[model samples]
Target chain A: MAPKYVLHYWPSIPGRGEYIRLAFEATGTAYTESNEPKTLLKHVMSCSKVGHPPHFAPPVLEIQLEAARSTKSRKTETSEDVKSSSPFFLSQTPAILAYLAPHLGLDGVKKGKNEEDPEVDQIRRAQVNQITLTILDLNSEVHDSHHPVASSAYYEEQVPEAKKRAEDLRKVRLPKFLKLFEETIASNEDEDHLYGSSLTTADLALFQLIDGIQFAFPKRAAALEKSGKYAKVFALKQAVAKLPKIKAYLESERRLPYSDGIFRHYPELDGED
Target chain B: MAPKYVLHYWPSIPGRGEYIRLAFEATGTAYTESNEPKTLLKHVMSCSKVGHPPHFAPPVLEIQLEAARSTKSRKTETSEDVKSSSPFFLSQTPAILAYLAPHLGLDGVKKGKNEEDPEVDQIRRAQVNQITLTILDLNSEVHDSHHPVASSAYYEEQVPEAKKRAEDLRKVRLPKFLKLFEETIASNEDEDHLYGSSLTTADLALFQLIDGIQFAFPKRAAALEKSGKYAKVFALKQAVAKLPKIKAYLESERRLPYSDGIFRHYPELDGED
Candidate 1:
């Protein structure tokens, strides 16, 4: 049976697709990931559906409304309903996450009297997105540490520059970003989440970011973890890992390993504290 | 009287904040930008308000609800209303833009009977955000062309790596992104906008992205423009610039010049196509 949600990305490494995957896995939602290169290429290279524009890159989400399945028996369905029920494609990791977060119940809900207020909902959504964007920004910087010259070029080709970039990332950037997350987590009343008193897409994104950093920069990540300053952040990572569904997914075959993806384990790039 | 929107960013140079400024200018909205370094630093460096978290970087938007002004006369106002009317600080350029776009009427409106459908609204918002994010991704790459190793380091410190990065950007990445935008614009029924049949924050974002690219890489930008391949994109840029308020703002003192910001013009970095 075709799932309601389909994810099209590179077949091999997790890359940015993992952020989307984590959201689904955490929520125990059923989603289909296109692991076949040919099928994936066709969907990503062009507009697979009418009314959808071409995607610039991978990690695209195609959402088919459930009502479309029952449309065969319903004679009252209008053209507008048919168009609305058609498969909708969206790209950009953050954009996909934001769209899915609310549906997945990861975009924290407002409490009490403000529950019905759109302004409160908007503020909550923006806060979650801002934190997710910051995590991704650091994730981009991590990728650059190894491929500083050009992402197209191999790390071996840019070793000298990579060394400089990785050194700065370890000595300056990583700590700065980690501290910001630490402060942010401390600010929230709930110690386990990045936003409100709940697990949000931002928390899932942060978990993946720290997991990638650990894979890419073990020595630096270890030192920072040992420092105890980012206790809240590490706690959140542990909390996310311990989620029943997320744990099952991580140990399952669906979770791809890090290789030549954005978060790469290059020994020379890792530095001691 | 204070404007409803307060923009906090660096005092000089048209950086990411310019994207937000263009949205306001194009809509003729009243906004105050904090030009003093100290005032701006205070808002960005710490949580200026009790409920807000510390911003990771600049381009933070402080939105004060209008109901707060009439609170003195409204004796029946509840505490929930007071809290909702408090100033909300949001960071992240795309987040700020997404939050402001709908209010500015740049998120695009549905013209048909499906207008009331929340799913339709969500899809439209995601499309606008996805395009805006893609443009910003290209913009980030342009910034990296000059400061390939580290954003904190001076461009002079990484000139060797900058050359290689800029070469890839000018010859490969820039053209690839431009082609995608061109295809997207052509895909739309309205040739002037990137998404629907109207001006959106995505269009405003694309205009600023191209404007900064032209300023930073004159040779490559001019070659691409003269190639006439991306006719729709350039036409869109021209359309955005010719907006009555945008034209006036561009000529006003409020619009800062490009300097040592994200899009820097190092003659050595700008290469021939």
Candidate 2:
């Protein structure tokens, strides 16, 4: 029997958790996701008390292994320790993805000796990781657009500053990041994927980023996509959208619409293209 | 002979480079660092053109491997291909530290089967990584205190908004993060290190963070340290500071002062304890 996997994340917003879901959906992996936001928050808050590794934030994946059955023979045990033996939990999105991708065949290829440039594999994977980090940085910048002065403060209290941040993100940082991604895609002349010939988690992440950007800054994302400058990026997004599993997931109820997420669609924040 | 390691970062500011430097200094590793700002910028800019992995920012580590010497016999001699064989570069501070820590013996121990809780090692390392990332997150928040509205703009342009961000950070966020670090330290029982019984890169990173916080917000950091709430965290800082190499590095010219770094000492931002 296949081991059971449970993912705990806020059900309403497809924020950072959506990145993990994309990999699972793309690979046709079976996993259950917690749907209650309050329960998810409670679990994250109490992660340390249960002797599980303290997760600073959520999108935690709990993996139940076959080895857990042996734990029944132990004499002295609490509920948490009993579960701890066979089922381990991992937190932090990137760490979880890196751990899972290798097992799921979604990681970069381990090139052979006969390959023309076998050394490029290490560098390729490192670059993929770098690009992924840059994407997260961009995601943070997008979040800051609305919460510029203080995350503790509401959007209404920081309207003027939000406008300033949105303007910089729109005019300066957005174009800069788009160009960087566009250049990376263009580097692989023959393939639509972000890394190598086959799809990796980085490609999936890139697709999600493009998707979120389109939803958040409709006018700007549309104008940029139409500009012909980032042709490869636009092409990759279309390609990812058409993948059979991804297409199905997008059409299904599982795919939550963008509202209160890292990439938010605020009409005031979205300037003219 | 060991491989030559060269670190490239901004000359004046400790910035992100300080994290990498802490590991090297604590372990007494010998590595050269570039001091000229123009050369550092040029190297970072040309990273892509050289066919090496492009670092989006500085604190790039260049490793020249002895294994790379075998490539001389290969017929393919493009400049990019030639350089790719002998020397490789890694960027992004967290990734660099993760890659180097194992070689420097600063990584967590691989527990034996006889150990009571062998399963804890994996969880331990993941939590350490999480803490390191959280430290970076705090570092970013500290930076935003000085440049709340625009990073591209000068500090003078965003003074008013910076004050608001600083007030929130000094009063709310700083205490919250200090409390988190304090809780983590207290979890280790009698140990002075952040994890297990010995020192790991996370401890060095924690030390750097405490050092920077003290420099950037002297009034607040000193008060927190004196209040005795974070006793273990303060003890860890003292322990790391007394490490022979680290103490030498601190008193030497190589340990650059905190000017124009992520954690700048703005008098207004310091506020009160």
Candidate 3:
């Protein structure tokens, strides 16, 4: 039986949760991709769920584990008996991705189950973790382009600062990240994926990372594309887009574009050199 | 034989690597503690060691592994025998701890070699990762204490914006983090440790987190500590201070206090109210 994955993300834009969605899609996994913002809001507002909640934000993955509840245990029950019928819900996209990847057979590790080889799994997961960490860093960098002056303050208030920072960010950090990816691809003996020569979730993740960067910094990215070092990365990204599952999802109303999400484009924040 | 730990750190302060150091001390593990900062710099700087061709900051843990060394039969003498030797360095503190915990018997399920228990490890690790993430966020908040207005600008350049952001930060986020920790301890069944009962690295980490917060925001912490909900947490901090290895190390010339590291104090940033 194919495992069903219900990925709950914000309806508006493809933010952090898109990585998980992409991985599930790439592997041809059966999953419910729901972007019901109302559903997400309800979960976030709930007391049991929002324990030590975020300072501000949404896009939580609500996971439902449906197994045959033991009818034998239900006959006589104490307060702690019967066992939780309602499934587990976790926030934090990185944590959720780390949790889910192995279950989907996309991660190739013992992962959460501990059934497979851990030594190998540890290395694999570490590689995955490294990729995600880089993605998170990239996301933060994109956010910084608009709110470079103050994360708490309005972007309008810091437009001057943003103008200054965006110049160096585009020229310095953008190329650095690209060249890093280029070198990573160049280092790979295999033509296909990032780690152990398999199409792990990391590549799917890097696609989102680069895609988001390109969306936000088109003027800068265009200059970069002309430089021609990241052809393999760009090719992999195009190939990922061409996947039938991904193509269908993109065509569907569910797939979101970059606007008011983690990757926001501000033409004023753009600087060309 | 007792597991040997080759901790790669700055040789200056117990920043992120302190968590591992604390674990080693608590267990009384017999191992070589090489405090070679220059050696660390050299190893991390070497492109041949890491796959991506540069350093990802300091403090990489080196583990020795022997692989089958997959090489074709003709091999052509392997083009100068390009292969890594006995030691393998793992970056990121969380990655290193995950590698060492099982070996040190700090892990719960000791099913011996090849034991694949991911849940027992994952729950604890996820919790640990959450705290580490929180601490990093908190440290960034600490950075805001000095340069709240911008990352690109130096401390002196953004003093005005820093002051206002720091004031708002002290009044709001500082208390929020402390209260969360207080609540975590008060609500936990195992009050001593933040994660599931007993002295896992998470408890020591929380102590470090709190200690850093206290050091960085003395006045705000004083106000927060008045709640008295973190009695066990405070006790754990005290207990860690008294640990023979930690105590000796602390008394030795080795342990250094906060400066420009992750946790820093800006007199203007903190407030009593």
Candidate 4:
């Protein structure tokens, strides 16, 4: 049996976790989410030094495979402050994705066709990398929609700036992103996925991106999705949704609806076409 | 001799290519740079359809090892038009770092003493990811220094707003980032590297990041660097610089300096204490 995968994400908002969820769905993988109510409400004492960052942000897909007790612990766990020592238990989103991609077959896309086809993998990997970066850029845009100035500042404080950012996102960023995805799909005519015909992490990401955008900007997304250019993306999303295990999971309580996730809808941060 | 690698980068900038060059130097990899001005300029068109977009601007790394030619003959290439249909390429700076870290023996820090410990990899990988994301945030700040409004806008046009953004970046973002690196180093008390006391991609990135920051924000960086908190980061930069191959490479013309790269110097954007 494969390892029992555990996803650590803030319970309320989908934010980055949706990508992981969609990826698992696309692969028909069974995993549990560790999104307890206290996870968010409780204070997170960030790592001071010794260990890795304690669960670097949410949406971390923690691999539950037991190590062989792991190297006998060079860094001693005994310290007056846990913060001072005990080595970080875990953190870093890309590292998690890199570790999981190979296990989940999404990484195989990076490899070339033959046993020696590591070259082939580069194209796929690059595609995934590019999309992921784009996703982050989109994320920044999305973030600016609510917090146009300081991210740490409240929406109420920056509501006016947020309105401008939101308007810009709706008018410029959203369409630009959708068009880029549409172009990517159109460019990859024969291949069923972003890099190649078979599905990969890039596709899962695209699905999540579209889903998030649609949720956050329903009016704008409706207009963009109606343009008929997103048929392939729509098809990809439908395919992921229709996956037997994924569909079952979505239907079940496991699949949370979009609310406070990365792509949150403040309504006013959104507008109609 | 292993295959001579082909490095495809925009010849104009040292952005992402600098990281790759640092890795290659560390590994003693002999590779030819395909910094053809025409090729770099031409590839920009096809870059749009290449699937992913960086959250903003960037330098992408292309793996130059030869693969099967005639990617153009294949319909897959047709989906995404290319000025030159290269068989395989990798993009997004962090992903490229992840790919190269293993090949360059930078993974030794993560691989652990036994060489079989996966947790070591996970822990180190996590740190590298954490540092990379922080670097991206830092770069975004650097970009905002020049164009606070949007990337689509001209830099000169946004100089007034850029000054305010740069002020915020210098006072808040720069100190915060420097402090983070400083704290990580001070807390670890380990020699050199951020993860497990051995050189890794994190170290290379830290070196470049500090170098870029110092070059771009001379006044602020001078203050931050003089504040004495980033001692380890400074030490890491020196350690990496001392590596024979790296030193030779940096001295040689192959290592380009920053001008129009992702990290730029616009003295007007900054503020005095």
Top candidate, metric DockQ: 1
lDDT of 4 by residue, A24-64 (tens): 77687887777785643221224442244333245555554
Off by over 4 Å in 2: A1-4, A45-48, A66-86, A111-125, A188-191, B45-48, B66-86, B111-124
Please list the C-alpha lDDT of all candidates, in the order they appear: 0.84, 0.74, 0.60, 0.62
Predicted candidate 2 versus true structure: per-residue lDDT over A167-250, tens digit per residue: 888888888777767766765534577666667777888888888988889988888887888888889988998999999999
On DockQ, the stronger of 2 and 4 is 2
Q: Tell me what fraction of the real C-alpha contacts between chains A and B each candidate also makes.
A: 0.55, 0.24, 0.06, 0.22
Per-residue lDDT of A1-273 in model 1, one digit per residue for the tens? 233898988988999999999999999898888768776666563653445567888888888764543454245456666665467788999899888888888887655645545565777788788889999999889988988887777789899989999999999899889888988888777877888888899999999999999999999899999999889999999999999999999999999999999999888889786
lDDT of 4 at A228: 77
Interface RMSD of 1: 2.6
Residue B23 alpha-carbon offset, candidate 3, angstroms: 3.8
Which residues of candidate 3, in runs, are more than 4 Å off?
A1-5, A33-59, A66-86, A108-117, A149-152, B1-4, B29-38, B42-46, B52-55, B66-86, B98-124, B144-154, B227-254
Total backbone clashes of model 1?
Answer: 0
lDDT of 3 by residue, A1-273 (tens): 222456667777787778777877777766786667776666553434434222123445544433322332233433242233224345555556666666665563533443332443555576566555555666666776676545667878878667756776787677666665665556555546554455666677777887887888788777777778777778777776777777887788767777887787888776567
Most accurate candidate by lDDT: 1
Measured with DockQ on alpha carbons, how good is candidate 3?
A: 0.22
Taken in order, the candidates have interface RMSDs of 2.6, 3.9, 4.9, 4.9
TM-score: model 1, chain A: 0.91
Q: What is the Å distance of residue B23 in model 2 from its true position?
A: 1.5
* Model 4 misplacement above 4 A: A25-30, A36-45, A48-50, A53-56, A67-90, A108-113, A116-127, A189-191, A266-273, B1-3, B45-60, B64-86, B109-130, B186-189
Q: How many backbone clashes does candidate 2 have?
A: 0
